[model samples]
Each structure stands twice: as C-alpha cells, then as structure tokens.
Target: MSKKKSFPLRLDPELYEILQKWAADDFRSVNSHIEFLLREAAKKAGRLKKSQE
Candidate 1:
C-alpha cells in the first residue's frame, strides 16, 4: 500500500450525492472514487505527471 495523507474536504450536498451514487455503481468506497476522480481531473489539467509522485 502507498503512504496515505489525510486531509479534509468540503462538498455541496447535491454533488456529494452524485459522487456517492457513482461510487456505489462502481463498487468502490466513496473516498476511493473521489480519489480516482481527482487523479483524472489532475491528469487533464496537467497538474500531475507520470512520475511526479
């Protein structure tokens, strides 16, 4: 397993529900799904590179 960093996040109720549903559909925990979404978003924005981490 990778080293984990804990942080606090805030989300709107509506967006939170949508993410929750998507997580359930994918059979993943909500936190994992959010992490995946963040990774993808970062890839598109070029904030994350192949070896940055």
Candidate 2:
C-alpha cells in the first residue's frame, strides 16, 4: 500500500455529528468514511487517475 497523506480538516459541529453517525452506520472509522466519500467524488469527476490506483 502507498503511504496515505495527512492534513487537518475543519467541520461544522452539526456536520461532524452527521458524519459520525454515517460512519458508524457504515461500520467505518470517521476518517476512513471521509476518505471513501472523497475518493468516490473524485472518481465521478474524473480527477482520480488510474495510475494512482
């Protein structure tokens, strides 16, 4: 596996609560859930390269 990059994220309290719930429902850690969502979005936008896989 490639090294994962890290960065600080800021979220509104309400949004954080929503994400926490969603993550739990999906059986994913909050950070992993966020990454999954972002990856899906980038794939949809054609911003994620196959080479990066």
Candidate 3:
C-alpha cells in the first residue's frame, strides 16, 4: 500500500454528525467515506486521471 497523506480537517458540528451517520450506513469510517466521496467527485469532474482513480 502507498503511504497516505495526513492533514487536519475541520468541519461544522452538524456536517460532521451527518457524515458520521452516512459513514455508518456504508460500513466505512467517516474519514474513508469522505475520501471516497471526494474521489468519485474528482472523477466526475474530470479532475482525476484514470490511473489515479
């Protein structure tokens, strides 16, 4: 596995709670869900290359 970058992220309490529930529904941690969402969005926007995806 490649080394993943780590950074601090801040979100509003309401947003965080929503993400927590969504993550649980998908059987994923909140962090992983966020990454998944971002990756899919990048792909849809043509911002992510095939290899990257």
Please name the candidate that would achieve the greatest lDDT relative to the true structure: 3
Candidate 2 matches the true fold with a TM-score of 0.89
Query: Model 1 over residues 1-53: C-alpha lDDT tens digits?
Result: 87989999999999999999999999999899999988999988989978853
Listed in order, each prediction's TM-score against the native is: 0.79, 0.89, 0.96
lDDT of each residue in 6-40, candidate 2, tens digit only: 99999999999999999999999999999999999
lDDT of 3 by residue, 1-53 (tens): 88999999999999999999999999999999999999999999999988897
Which runs of model 2 end up more than 4 angstroms from their true locations? none
Residue 25, model 3, lDDT: 100
Candidates' C-alpha lDDT? 0.92, 0.94, 0.97
**Which candidate, 1 or 2, has the higher TM-score?**
2
- For model 3, the superposed segments whose C-alpha errors exceed 4 Å read none
User: What are the runs in model 1 whose C-alpha is more than 4 Å off?
Assistant: none
lDDT of 3: 0.97
Q: Which residue pairs does candidate 2 place in steric collision?
A: none
lDDT of 3 at 9: 100
